[model samples]
Target: MELRDIDLNLLVVFNELLHQGRVSAAARTLGMSQPAVSNALSRLRKLLGDDVFLNTSKGMVPTPLSERLAEPIAFALGTIHDTLNSKAEFDPATSARNFTVAMTDIGEISFLPALMKRLSEVAPGVTLSTVRNTAVNLREEMENARTDLAIGFLPDLQTGFFQRRLFSQRYVCLFRKGHPLAEQGITLKSFCAAEHVAIVAAGTGHGMVDESIQRAGITRKVRLQVPHFVAVGHILQTTDLIAVVPEAYAKRTLEPFDLETAVCPVKIPQIVINMLWHGRHHREPGNQWLRQTVFEEFSS
Candidate 1:
C-alpha cells in the first residue's frame, strides 16, 4: 500500500470504528452515515491489503492488524487535535461544552451539587452528565472519550490513565439522631452486636469495613444489604439498622435525615477518592478546564 492511496479521513473513521466496535455507532460518533463509514472501512481494507475488522456476533471485532494500528492511530489523531485546540483559548464563561463524568452514587450525593453550582456561576452555558462507574467498562469508556472524567474510589484503572487525589475519607457509622448507639459512643462490642446495613457498592458482599472486621477476626450481623449509599439514609432513619459509609458522604447526606455520625469501631483503610481521565484528553483545552475546575473544588 502506498501513502497516496490512504485517505486521512478514512483513518479517522477507522479509529472511531475501533472505539465503537460497530459501523452504526461509528457513524453516529463521526456524524456520518452508516454507508459512509462502511465505505471508508472498505477503502482502508483495500489500502492496507488486510481485512481490518471482521463482523462478528459481538459487533465489529478488529483483526490483528487493526488491533496493532489502533493505538498509534488514536495517538496521532489525539496529538493533532490537541495541538490544534491548544492554540485556542478556553473561555469557560462563554464556551458551551458538555462534559460527561462517571462516578458512584455516593459521588452524585457528595460532589455533583457543588460542582453544578460552581459551573453555573463560572460557566453558565456549560453542562454535565453523570454515569455509573461500574467496574466492567470504565477503562474502555475513558479510552474512547465516552466519559470525560471519572471521580470515585477507583483502584483498578491501569495504564494510559491519569489520576489526582481529591481527598481521603474514612468509614463512619451512621444512625438516627436518637439511636441508642449515639447516646453512649459506639464500642467494638456494641458495633458487632447491632444489626447493620452493608452497602455492596461494587456488587461485592464485602466492602472495606467488612474486610477490616474480617482481618480482626470479628463479625457483624448484617441485617440488610443495599447497592447504593443513597438508600442507606432512609433505611437508617426508619429502622434500628446502622450503616458504614464514607465520612464525606455521610457528613453531607446524613444531615437531611437527622442522622448522627460516629467513627467506625473497626479499623479500615482510608478511602482515597481520585479524579481520573484518559491521556487522550490531557492537553485538550476544554478537558483541561474541566479538570482544573474539579481540582480546585475538591482538592482544596
Candidate 2:
C-alpha cells in the first residue's frame, strides 16, 4: 500500500462508482468507457487491499470502509470544484443558484409562503427544493454536505454543527370552528375525554404535549397517530379529532382551513426552533447569505 505507487486517478473512479452505483453508469457519468472504469476499480481494490464495492442483486453497494470514506471524498471534490470555479461574490439579483434544504412538513408549511414571497422579489433567479424529514438525522446530512440547511427542532445535534434560534413556539390544541369545545374553554378533564390525533414521529407514540399531560397526572387518549402536522390540519377539517400542533404552524396552516385554536388543556413547554448547519461552510459566502436571508425572513 505504498502511497507513491497508488494511482491517484483511481480515487476519482472510485468516487464516481459510489455516486452512480454501477460501473456502466459511473463510466457514463465520468465520460469514460465501462471497461476502463472497471479496470480502475480493480486496481484500486488491490492497492487498498479491500473490496471497496460489491455487486449484489440490486446493484453495486459500497463497503463499510467506502461508506466511511464517501463524505471526505465528496467534500474534497466539492471544495476543489468551488475553488476552481469560485465566484467573487454571490449577487442575489443576478445569480441563479439552486439550493436544497431539509425541513419537516410543518417548517415548509409555516415558512415557505413568506420565504417564497421574499425570494421572488429579491432573488428571482434562485430556486429551492425541500427534502422530507423522515428521521432526526439532520446532523449527519448537514455534515455530509447533502443538505444546505436543516430547519427543524433537532434536540440532539452534534458539536460540529451550529444552530441559530429562529423563534420559540409552543403547542396549542386545534379543532374545527364552532365545535362543542368552542362553547367553553378546554379543560384538562374535557380534553382527555375528546378524541385526539397524535402527531407521532421516529417511532415515538407521544409528543411533547403528551409528556406534559402525563406530568400533570392526566392521560389524554390518542385515537389517531399520524406522521406529519399538515395531515393534522386536513383531519381536523373533516373530523372531530383534535390535534396539538406547534403554535406557529397551527396558525399558518389552519388559516385557510376552518379551524379554531384552544389553549392547551395541559401546560406544555415551548419548542425552540433552530436552523442548523455544519461548520465546514461556516464562513462560505453563499451559505452566509442563505443563513442571513432565512433569519431575516423568519424574524420579520
Candidate 3:
C-alpha cells in the first residue's frame, strides 16, 4: 500500500468499511452517503494500485492489502483521537463535554442518581450517556474512545483495563420491613423455607449472588425471576418474597422500597464493584476528574 498517498480522511472511511464489512453500514456510521463511502474506497484503491475490498455475496471482503493495513491504521487513528481528548487541563464547569459509561441496570438505579446530583452541582454543562455493559464490546469501545468508562462487577475487564475499587459487600437477605420473615430475622431455616424473588441481572456478574447461595447447599424456592435489579426493590416490597442482594445495593433499596435486610444465612463471597477505564485514557484530565468524582462518591 502507498502510505504516503493515503488521505487521512479516507483512512477513517476505510477503517469503518473494514469493521462493518459493507459500504452502506460504514456510510451510515460515518454519517456519509453510500456513494461518498464508495468514492473514498475508490480513492484508497487508486492510491494502493489494487482493490482494497471486493464485493462478494457475503459482503465486502477485504483484500490481503487491506487486511494488512487495518491494524496500523486503527492504531494511528486511535492515537490521534486520544491525543486530542487528553487536554492538559479540564474545566468541567464550562466545557460541554460528553462521556459514555457502560453499566448494568443496577448501577443506573443505585449510582446514577447520586452521580448526576453531584455533577449538577459542579459540572452542569457535562453530560453522561450509559450503554448496557453486556450489549457491546466494552473493551474495544473504550480503547477507541467511543466509551469513556465502565462501572460494575465486570470480571471480564481484567486485561488491558485500569480499575479503581469502589467497594465490596456481601449478600444480604432483603424484604419488606413488615414481612413475616422480618419478625424472626433471617435464619437458615427461615431463609430456605421462604418463597423468593430472584434477580437475573444478566451479564454484570450479578448471577454470582445466586450461584454462591446454591453452592452453600441451601436453596430458596424462587417464585419469580426478573431480568434486572431495578425491579427487585419493588417486587420485594409488594410480595412476601425475599431476595439476596449485595449489601450496598440493599442499603439503597431500604427507604424507597421500605425494605429491611438481614445477614444471609448462607455465607457467600463478597462482590467487588469497580470503575474501569482503558489505559489509553489514563492520562486524560477529564477522565481523571471523572474517576476521582466517582471514587469519592461511591467508594467505601
Candidate 4:
C-alpha cells in the first residue's frame, strides 16, 4: 500500500521513468497520459525534496539521488515479480520439508525402518513426523494440511480422500519360541483352546479382524486384550499368551523377541493397507513424492 508513508504507486512510476528516461516515453509505457506522469513526478520531487531527473539535450537524465536508489528499487521489484511467478516443485535432496504421516503403531513397526533408510539415502534433509491414524481429528487434520499422509487400513477415510492399495495383510498367531504352541503347531482346536491376547483396535480398519473372528463363531480362550501392537511381542514373549497380528508385523517382531508365527487356523478378514491423502494434496509435489515413496517401499 505505502512505502515509508509514500504511495507505492509513485515508486512504480519512478522505476518506469528511470527505465524509459523521457516523460512521453514513460507515459506510453505506463499507459498514462504525459500530464499524469508529470503530476506524479512533481509529487515525488516534493516528497523526496530532490530533482530526481533532469531534462537534458539528449534525454531525461537521472539525477544523483535517482542513480543512488536505482539498483535497490530494481532489485526489490524484480524479486517480487520472480517470487509471484515461480512454480518450482519440491526437490527432495535439497528440501527441508517436515511431513506428517498418520499411522498405527503396527504401521510404524512395519513401515518406518525401510522408509527412514530410503529417506536417508535420497532425501537426507527432509524430515518425517507421525501421529496416530486413529486420532479423532485425523480427517480434519489431513484436510487442513497438518497431516500430509496416512498409511494403514483406513476405511473411514473414504470420502474426500485418495488412496492407493499397498498390500493385503493376512492374520497370523504370534508367540514366544518357547511357547507350547511352537511345538504343538496351531490347529483349529488348539488355537481355540490357547490363552490369547486380542488387540482391541476398536472401530477402525484393523477392528475388522476382531469382527471377523466374532462372526466365525470360534470361541477363543481370551486371556488379555490390548489396544495397540507396540507391546504385543514383548507381552507374548514373557507370557504364555499368543496374539493374532498381521503376518508382516509378526515376522518383524519374531527375531527381536525370539517369537514364532503359526498359520492362523480360522479364516479371518484380510486387512488391506493403503496409502491415503486428502484430495487437496493430490497434485502437490512433496505429497506425490511421499506417496510414491510409500507405494514403492511397502506396496505388494
Point to the candidate with the largest TM-score.
Answer: 4
Candidate 1, residue 152: CA error in Å?
1.0
lDDT value, candidate 4, whole model:
0.89
Instruction: Report the backbone clash tally of model 2.
Output: 0
Candidate scoring better on TM-score of 2 and 4: 4
Evaluate model 4: give its TM-score.
0.76
Q: How does model 1 score by TM-score?
A: 0.71
Candidate 4, which segments miss by more than 4 Å at Cα?
A: 1-77
Position 296, candidate 3: lDDT: 91
CA lDDT, every prediction?
Answer: 0.87, 0.82, 0.89, 0.89
Per-residue lDDT of candidate 1, residues 1-300 (tens digit):
677767889999989888899999999989999999888988888888899999999999999998899999999999989997877568999988889999888889989899999999999999998888875488899999989998888878869999999988788889998899999888999998899998887732226777788899988899998778878888899998888888887888666899999988888888788898999988888998999999999894
TM-score of each: 0.71, 0.68, 0.71, 0.76
Q: Which stretches of candidate 1 lie over 4 Å from their true place?
A: 1-86, 203-206
Q: Kindly give the stretch of ten consecutive residues in candidate 4 with the minimal lDDT sum.
A: 1-10
On the 0 to 100 scale, the lDDT of residue 126 in model 4 is 96
Candidate 3 lDDT over 115-201, as tens digits, reads: 999999999999999999888988889989999999999888878799989988788889998999888888889888999988887
Give the per-residue lDDT of model 2 (tens digit) for 84-185: 898668888887988778788778888899889988999999988888655646667778877888777776665998889998887889998877887876
User: Order of all candidates by TM-score, from best down to worst?
Assistant: 4, 1, 3, 2
Model 2 is weakest, by summed lDDT over 10 consecutive residues, at 201-210
